[model samples]
Target: MRHDHHGRTHRLELDDQSLRTWDSTVLASDPEDGLVLDRSAFYPGGGGQPPDQGVLLWGGVQTRIVGVRPRDDLWLVPDPDDPLPPVGTQVRGAVDDDRRSLLMRTHSGLHVLRGVMARDFGVPVTGGNMEPGQARLDFDLAEVPAGFKESLTEKLNAEVAADRAIQVRVLPRAQAYALGPIVKTATDLLPPDLEDIRLVDVVGLDLQADGGTHVASTKQIGRIEVAKVENKGRGFRRIRLKLVD
Candidate 1:
């Protein structure tokens, strides 16, 4: 399977992160199996980001998509009370701009955090999770410098103000792995047989193998506030961040 195709559904979001709405044909629709589309921009959740939520409009009715089940086929889970578009039905798919845009900014902001931490503290991210406007990353830091939280907040905002460009690219497996040690995770989780790899680059900051949507630049992330830093023991420190207006 190609990296851009999820099962039979052509994943439009992979190439166009800014695309919010598009026309598609319903390929399969089952009450229990969920719906599949010939083309979709709804991002299937992966790499610490959640799947997108939106609606499919057809025949003057709206079928609300609540979640996604990524499998052999990208199954779009719709709201139980909504009507389903039958196979071969033409429909208009729309991703919730507010939710997806915020997610893009938040995901990019986390990369900024990763960049700053790696550049300054030289630590690898152990784990992380994110929502629309908030995120937290765990790092394997043996010691926290004095005023570490304040220092990190300042550095994070500085990078945001820098407006560093974010670029996405797809490369052959060997070429991607050749950029040794790009995966920021404490453990490399990429599948062995995957022929193509998708990479997200916070230009001049951080680059990693990722499969999530992101903003065009760091400035699009807005102000990042380091809300808290908690010591999780065993040389693990959790840093929480919030995006402010």
Candidate 2:
């Protein structure tokens, strides 16, 4: 299967073996970076997060990998007409760290708020967006009171101030099943066979089967402010939030 880490770490550096794995493509000789790996950790714009872009280096040539997508396997596509490096060639792969860090922090921040909403308001999330510096999530709630939004804002800020640690781990499918029905019913994802399940836990705040990168701790999320709430009818409310300086 695909060796993925998009839901695990924010920034990762390549080592000897991993680097070799990335430079094995020989199909695009006249290519840009000419680097291609059997599997990649880059998130290809799924579940509301956008695709990642960065540069790959080969023989002093810096080629831009504009987009990453899953084909029969995950193919690292460089600019148009770019050739692939000869198979057995070694190249370096790098992700745009600044943009990746933003996604990681913002995505974790949204989850922090999500867990808080579930605990305090008994509202379940209907949908959400994990964007850079901006995020929004919808919940199934009766009616929105004027003070509710402000109250939530204060609560989420406190959670961030708590500085809780965030942890991610891989779990066997059966081992994960032992955690109980609460989580099993929440996600439709299954570990390939029984060894590919990955679990993301926010210490005491939240736990779920997720495949996205996140901040190491809640404190890194900074100040979360509830910007607005939209009533979408049928006890559905959407909350908009932003990071405060």
Candidate 3:
């Protein structure tokens, strides 16, 4: 049996390699120059990160694959009419630069917030989602402090202004296990191939096992404001934010 390996597999070398030059299978019916590959590192909008919006250039027509989906071992781009490249044909894929950049910053900013909550308020993330211009991260906190909204807003923006480097990598299971555990309660949520888990580390700040794209530095995130904070449950609070001047 042929082992099908494609979907959601974090490329450990993405940090070093150009994300645009991935060698992929032509999972389409009709061959084209710009066709979406079967397996892509592009996080199909999930867990809050909006689906990536990008163009697929083939022949002379530039087709946009503005959506992404994770299916077993395949990154499914649902474009019915758009012809698919042959099974073995190679193609060049490029992300929507502007949109992607915003997402990168937003994702990194969320991580900073997650780290801050963990260190200062003793909270762990419960859920989160990042849109184009705004983001919301949910945390497990017993009480929503009265002054924390303003203070957290200030603290997070300060970190972004400090311009800390955002690091990303794929670690072997053993190495990943060696790091201090930050994922609490849902250890079972880990995929069986723990060795292939991607780790997103913010130098001197935070470390998380994530597969989403991110900015290289926090400075690019610009000034962020905590727009609101609300109670979601007995011990859960959600923080909402957006970019500001």
Distance from true position, residue 205, model 1, in Å?
A: 0.4
Q: What is the lDDT of candidate 2?
A: 0.66
TM-score of 1: 0.99
Model 3 stretches astray by more than 4 angstroms: 1-13, 16-25, 30-41, 78-90, 184-188
Model 3 root mean square deviation, Cα atoms: 4.0
Per-residue accuracy of model 3 over 1-245 as CA lDDT, tens digit each:
12123443443224542264354445543322233365454556644678666655555654457576555543546355665555565555566767777777888889889878877877667777778768998887887767989999989988898899988776676777689873532234776755466678888888877767788888988889999998888987889988774
| CA RMSD of each candidate after superposition | 0.7, 4.9, 4.0
Which candidate comes out best when scored by TM-score? Answer: 1
lDDT of 2 at 192: 50
lDDT of each: 0.95, 0.66, 0.68
TM-score for each of the candidates: 0.99, 0.79, 0.82
Q: Estimate, for each residue in 24-122, the C-alpha lDDT of model 1 and write its tens digit.
A: 999999999899998999999998999999999999999999999999999999999999989999999999999999999999999999999999889
Worst 10 contiguous positions by lDDT, candidate 2: 12-21
Ranking by lDDT: 1, 3, 2
Worst 10 residues of 3 by lDDT: 1-10
User: If both were scored by lDDT, which would come out higher, candidate 2 or candidate 3?
Assistant: 3
State the lDDT of candidate 2 residue by residue for 1-245, as single tens digits: 42343222212321111121133232333354333464344556655566667766777676677776544434566777554456655666677777777777777788887788767776677777866778888888887777988898889888889999988876667876577432412245444564556666778887766666777889988888889999888888888988875
TM-score computed on alpha carbons, candidate 3: 0.82
